[model samples]
Target: MKAKKSLVALAVLGTLSGASYAQSSVTLYGIVDAGLLYTSNVKTAEGGKALLQLASGNLNGSRWGLLGSEDLGGGLKAIFRLENGFNVNNGTLGQGNRLFGRQAYVGLASNTYGTFTMGRQYNALQDYVATLQLVSALTQFSTHPYDNDDLNNTYRTDNTVKYATPKLAGFQAEALYGFSNSTNFANNRAYSLGANYSNGSFNLGAGYARSQSPGAIGGAIVGNPSSATPSNPLLDAARVDQWGVAGTYVLGSLTLGLLYSGSLYTNSTFTLAAPRGTIHFQNYEGSVRYQVSPTLMLVLGETYTTVHQSGESGHYLQTSAGADYYLSKRTDLYLNAFYQKASSNLQANIDGAGGAASGSSQAVVVAGIRHKF
Candidate 1:
């Protein structure tokens, strides 16, 4: 039986190689997820609206791509991947009309030294936020007070290089650096490090990242309005720094996860403006999940965030619950709800940034289906 299986595998490889026989073994795989969504008091910059919404893959953004690896011999392999994300409803590039935009990179993989690559990429914090959450890492739901930076961001850094280590006793680490690719004032660089370990029901992870004079929105706290208008401490840093630690434990049919994060800044400068004050933010998240059945789950989670805008500081709280059922290994259906309240100097929900509150809060409930192919 083993010999027969080997022969079958060889035949498939042979058929695939007919397209490019002498070079390498290459394969392609990807996922596409989509769903219809609704928001209660949808906050838009113009105003708030309540209506039926058809959101594309809020849980797992619909994506497709190609991955290939060529044997370079000498225990080294040339590897490349071009993944593109798209909006299912309108059939448009999901991330800013970028061809092979989601992840476009080429690098080398080695058995002994690990692997290194370069291109548009995510920082350490962006990758680990999912493992630390049990709501299946819902982008529109589980993010609560703040979504995972990477999932929500369409474009981060342009040029970059990354290295990931081979696993060590169920432990692995990665490091990344990004360059802005500019002529004058081109010292812009961002760096990050991440590490994780998993053993049985217990899993843990930690990560740190620093952005040197990055773009303001993704950069340090540039706050609202540019730096020139009086000094709003929130806009004090051109350099942004972030660090996080998160863990999960599975006990019987229940799983518990917790995460903590902090952000710091150095000099917040703006384009065509002077300088503002500094800003720092601290966030904490906790969640619990119970397996009600083989294909059903019950979850409850909360997030607390405190934003320190120079001397003045404010805080907010968010609570959420959601569930997912696997109709099959590659398809899922889900429903979720969120209730959020704020007591802060800043006014913003997950959707819009500025609003006048009755010290009022908002809520959302959504049901969606996701299929991966």
Candidate 2:
């Protein structure tokens, strides 16, 4: 009788353990990317000079993270993700040196409803519109001039609340709001809204974002307005508004995409002339990707941008092309090249280089490898 009781107790405990294991799970994942880069016409006081160096995150930022979820029954779950960004070359943190600068969010997800999250996160523009666009979807080198549209996710919002709707009838929608946490309302605040639709082989998306006093010192937004970082130019403005539309069509092994965006900086300090009023930028882009084989792919993209500021207008044209070869499911090699030209008094910023420009042209080439685990 004691043996029988012991066997029953062991079975009960094993059942409970299996249930507990099934109710929760955690995963760790990461990507590492690094490359050698060469740039032509790096601006300097004396003259434009070439640059050669080791680069990190040529196609995607290096990152590692933990994602976990606990089943809460009734089709609901508690979820959290903590992601970190770092430089592969220097083995240093990337996003403001914060351990989880890339993303840190926790929320509840309902299979019947949707998801609600709060923390540092990407705006809706990045989640919906930008990801579908070719310039932002392709290699990092393909971003619009200076990433003026924020399509490359130049900055992320902190202290944010976000809601994402479950896909219904091939449609999905999401929104985000970032608080300033200041006495003066609207100071350093940001908001975004976006939606996407997918049907058959066509996908379309659009989004809008606005920020007040973005990059203001000691404000909700962090960074120095005058400092030039690899991913951020830190252009200060009283108010900024941006909107974009993007679409992609897939056919067999080829995909084509189109993107358009407009950004307006009001009462800006980054303008060329004094008495700063507003600086406007409009971008148009197109891109194509072809899978030559199961393991090889080719991509090409182009963007044309117009800048309007203080009765002056400038034109910029940027082109990017690349080839990617996959050695394994989690590892790949790539070669990407980009060229940008400016006309009509436009300062040649050239893909966030923040250099001195002798002329209106800049070019860069990057060869790299990426691994995911």
Candidate 3:
């Protein structure tokens, strides 16, 4: 009888140990960055002037996140991530003051299949095309004029359901839909699709997104409209359509990239002080990164944008250069600069770093350090 009881007890303990091993796994991760910045041509109702101040997120945004996974047997797992973006200077939330503004998602993953998630999340365009832009390589300061096409991740979609396919033969695809969740059903709907192909050192991607009345309450787009220098003006439009394509090639320690995107805002409320009208913008950019040594890197890029209104047109030209010295795998120091010139009635602006420019040109310089944990 004692021998039989011992066998049963051993089996129970083995099962409990297996369950614990499969269900208990969590991680904490974060990045912190701080810097000093100089800006020329900050425009206000009063006037424009050059200014210098301490800044955060010069090379990368400051953020902290928690992620966890549970193995559910049968090659499937449950996963979740909660990420928060914050300003290092004042210790405030970054995305419209939301605690987990950067990302908050719960999903399931399968080794043979792909992953599916739901919650506030990034659209397909940002995941596929915008991430390949050279402007992103140079940092937020080099973002395309106004970041009109969402390349700089100005906002995220709420009430979203997203699916990403497993990479097969160097190809992967993603789709997302955000619900308006209103009585009208489609009052503020948003959706996007994107695909990418990679082989060896070359990658190409494209994506498209559309939204209607996005500025409505609890909508897909999120930003502070009252701010003098809003990041993206089309967020308040009656309708918005955007698409982009990007490619990058790597050779040894050198990399080159090219990107193009266009955005159309129909019946937009904000058009550089215009009351209402249709506005369109096209942006093209090229960028290169070279490793000077195992610890040092260099980057350069340029972007040109063309804008069209009912009876007016404008243009923007921007140049960026930057360098980074790696102190370790998780820490780095950097210097970066950007100069932009606007034509016609378009005002120069670098969101978060500088205000709208009263004149036709704006320039900014930044130096910073970043650490990851």
lDDT of 2 by residue, 1-373 (tens): 9999999999899779968665877899999998898888887776889988888887888999999998888999999999999999889998778899889999999987999999889887888887887644446767777677788877788889999998999999998998888887678888999999999999999999988887654444563556443224434777888899999999999999988999988867665423456888899988899999999999999889998887778888988889999999999999888888888476565664335357888888889899999
The model with the greater TM-score, 1 or 3, is: 3
Model 3 error, position 308 (Å): 0.7
Clash pairs for candidate 2: 43-356
Tell me the alpha-carbon RMSD of every candidate: 6.2, 4.6, 5.4
State the lDDT of candidate 1 residue by residue for 249-360, as single tens digits.
9999998989887776655442111224565667788988888898887788898877655466667688888888889887878887777777744443653212223333
lDDT of 3 by residue, 127-217 (tens): 9897788755666888877778887888888889999998899999999998888887787889999999999999999999998887676
Each prediction's whole-model lDDT (CA): 0.66, 0.82, 0.85
| Model 1: CA > 4 A from native | 1-13, 16-25, 43-48, 134-136, 144-155, 184-186, 216-237, 265-276, 351-359
Q: Is candidate 2 or candidate 3 better by lDDT?
A: 3
Candidate number with greatest lDDT = 3
Model 2, stretches more than 4 Å misplaced? 1-18, 135-137, 218-220, 226-234, 272-275, 353-356
* RMSD (CA, angstroms), candidate 2: 4.6
lDDT (0-100) at residue 103 of candidate 1?
Answer: 82
For model 3, the run of ten residues with the poorest summed lDDT: 222-231
